[model samples]
Target: MGVTRERAIERLAGRHPGRRGFGGSADPAEAAAFRHAMRGDHDLNPGVTPPSTALTPAAVLVPLIDHRDGMSVLLTQRTAHLTAHAGQISFPGGRVEDADPDDVAAALRETEEEVGLPRDRVSVIGRLDTYITGTGFEIAPIVGIVDPPVPISIDPFEVAEAFEVPLSFILDRRNHQRIEREVGAHNRAYFVLPYEGRNIWGATAGILVNLAEVLAD
Candidate 1:
């Protein structure tokens, strides 16, 4: 069974188990304003700039809730053949094309092309903050609500598998685990959510952390 609209909304509204410092506690108005500023404007975070000089524009489609289990977020694992971030868990998206009018359109178009998810079936709610990846792509994360019972076809060349994680599980503050690792010559700290068999970390996890903060507020 697919998730219903009411159930999805309820899940988003419910308290998240993984609530951490990353998920700021603020009033709805303040939180909404922060989210809006982050999404609308690019320079919200002036201190943390892109590490690389390359600037490829990309858009990620964050599908929230497919009907059967109320509200679940869809994610994908990229095929190892990819040049960048191969074998990493990520949202369905890619570099924007000249044919796409804007970021949102590009995201929807890419989702359809990569995952066989029809654009018409997705209702975009809003966008999250843009993230500058270490690999040089400036990614705009667009959150959308997908109706249940929709069929999906995965492109074997780009996507290894497609799966859904309950939004509630993602939203809960307790599930967000913080850890440190050595990257190159420096130590790096990040969040990780080990869902099913997939280890969602790095840029993908950072995006989810931002989303969790917004939803918690």
Candidate 2:
């Protein structure tokens, strides 16, 4: 790809604020209202996060791997036995633990723990908007560049397998679709990115869209 790591960083820096959401959101605690709003709003399947609701803070690393041919994003398939989002595609990350210093630190730490990708091998360039899920998670999507690819060693309990999707493909909004599903007697619509026959949906898909918009030319 013609977009170099430096160029990606420059593009991210172009944003007025590093991230956005309710109350300039990124922290779900700042979540203002909970309504059935998903018409023009980019976020679909958003759940009720009343201002008083204390959402669990989480972070995920949107790892952009640098290859000679181009850039690709590293994603993971959660182990089928896991509780939430079992067997679904996701970026490497988890809840922000008390031991972690901040969102970035938690993202890097969780990444290393989940996929054995070293913290030192990645350079965090920027972030996408904070995303809230129907399951009550306030996710901080931290964008990072990974150079000098490392052999992935996945945790069997947390990840089933690790894979990559070309960044260019994800950047093309055309590759995404708005699909509706019935959840608890209600219809909820969300974006889905199909890659190699696998469907990347929900928050993972939303974050990918966020990345595409943030790095748009």
**How high a TM-score does candidate 2 get?**
0.85
Model 1 TM: 0.77
Look at candidate 2 and tell me the lDDT of residue 172. 88
Candidate 2 lDDT by residue in tens digits, 1-217 = 4567878999876443323234334554334433112111335535633233455778999999999888899999999999888999999999999899888999999999999999999888877777776666668888899985666888999999999999899988899899987768877788999999899988899889878877778
Error of 2 at 204 (Å): 0.4
Candidate 1 stretches with Cα past 4 Å from truth are 1-49, 52-54, 66-69
Worst 10 residues of 1 by lDDT: 16-25
TM-score per prediction, in order, is 0.77, 0.85
User: Per-residue alpha-carbon lDDT of model 1 for 104-146, expressed as tens digits?
Assistant: 8999999998899999988876676676665656677877888
Residue 142 of model 1 has an lDDT of: 79
